[model samples]
Target: MEELLKTLNNIRSLRLLAKEIPLEQLETILKKFELVVQERKEEEEAQQLVLAAHQEKIEKYKELLKSEGISPEELLEVMNLHRFNPSQHKKRAPRPAKYKYTDLDGSQKTWTGQGRTPKAIQIQLDKGVTLESFEI
Candidate 1:
């Protein structure tokens, strides 16, 4: 009962708020909302057509497999048997030393060729030093 009362109050509040809004502004807002709804409907229809076409293609392929005595379950089992390890799907980190160069003090600096340039490398770069000069 309390929930129903709260919902009724919310509706009344919205109606009062709507009455306060200018008629011309409300009409314009409604037109824009209607346009959005129309566009959404069109997009959904296009997607439905695309989904139907793909479903048709899938049915044809299934029929072809049936004619060849191959079931979808068998195909799935064969694929599952040769599935790659989970670790193989992970992205590998770049090696820390793709390029190495010596500073004026004879200390070494290395870059992985990723992310921001280190201060040591940036100074050389600002001087127009070629990146190839630092190649490993």
Candidate 2:
């Protein structure tokens, strides 16, 4: 973010400089920006060609599978039976317990730290001590 801010300031300085400088120097700077735009356009065209080639190759593979008597659904069933499932292997995020108050018998009282504050905790807030004071 800082680097981008510096670059934006530099461009503003250059724009101001163009007003006081000779026409030839300003035209040169303009031409450089135009060259960068042209280069990006050429790169985009090349990428589109590569993407089309990959799509064509994938279509060819699909035809080959169909000719050999396999449909997409059959392939999916085979893959599902043995595939590495990211979701199945994932561990759920551990929820940190928030206990902010207790009853007269000393049972632990809890909160999930979202939505409207619980009444017991609200009573503490009304008395002027914060929820952090009772956090376990």
Candidate 3:
């Protein structure tokens, strides 16, 4: 691709510098360019046909749903209810607490010891208290 682009650039520079290209060579280049344009047009038309077919199928399904008294919104809601959304997974049961302590406010609290150290535990630890001392 890079070499093709370089060749094209060289041809462009030559065209700019030359007084005229020979008629036969110019005709040959024009024919190749026209073939490329025709191929592109055919590919575009094929894509349009595929898109039109897909749209037609969608419209037909919509009409069928309407005939059966189901609105598009209802269909979408039903689909969402059955969809396997990652966030909708059943939550794991809470981990059992591993430590118990009393807060500054005199309320009991427990920790699974998986997250940040609780303020009550932190204060005791700051005073050289061992974490195992609070384990349940």
lDDT of 2 by residue, 11-81 (tens): 78666666788999878977997999899999999999999999999999899999999998999899998
TM-score-wise, the better of 2 and 3 is: 3
lDDT against the true structure, per candidate, is 0.86, 0.82, 0.91
Best by lDDT: 3
Residue-by-residue lDDT tens digits, candidate 3, 1-136? 9876765669676575344777788788889989999999999999999999999999999999999999999989999999899897899999999999999899999999998999989999999999999999
| lDDT score for residue 13 of model 3 | 64
Per-residue CA lDDT of candidate 1, range 43-98, in tens? 99999999999999999999999999999999999998789978668888767688
Candidates 1 and 2, the one with greater lDDT: 1
- Tell me which residue pairs clash in candidate 3: none
Q: Which has the greatest TM-score?
A: 3
> Which scores higher on TM-score, 1 or 3?
3
lDDT of 1 at 25: 86
At residue 14, what lDDT does model 1 achieve? Answer: 57
Q: How many pairs collide in each candidate, listed in order?
A: 0, 0, 0
lDDT of 1 at 118: 72
TM-score of 2: 0.48
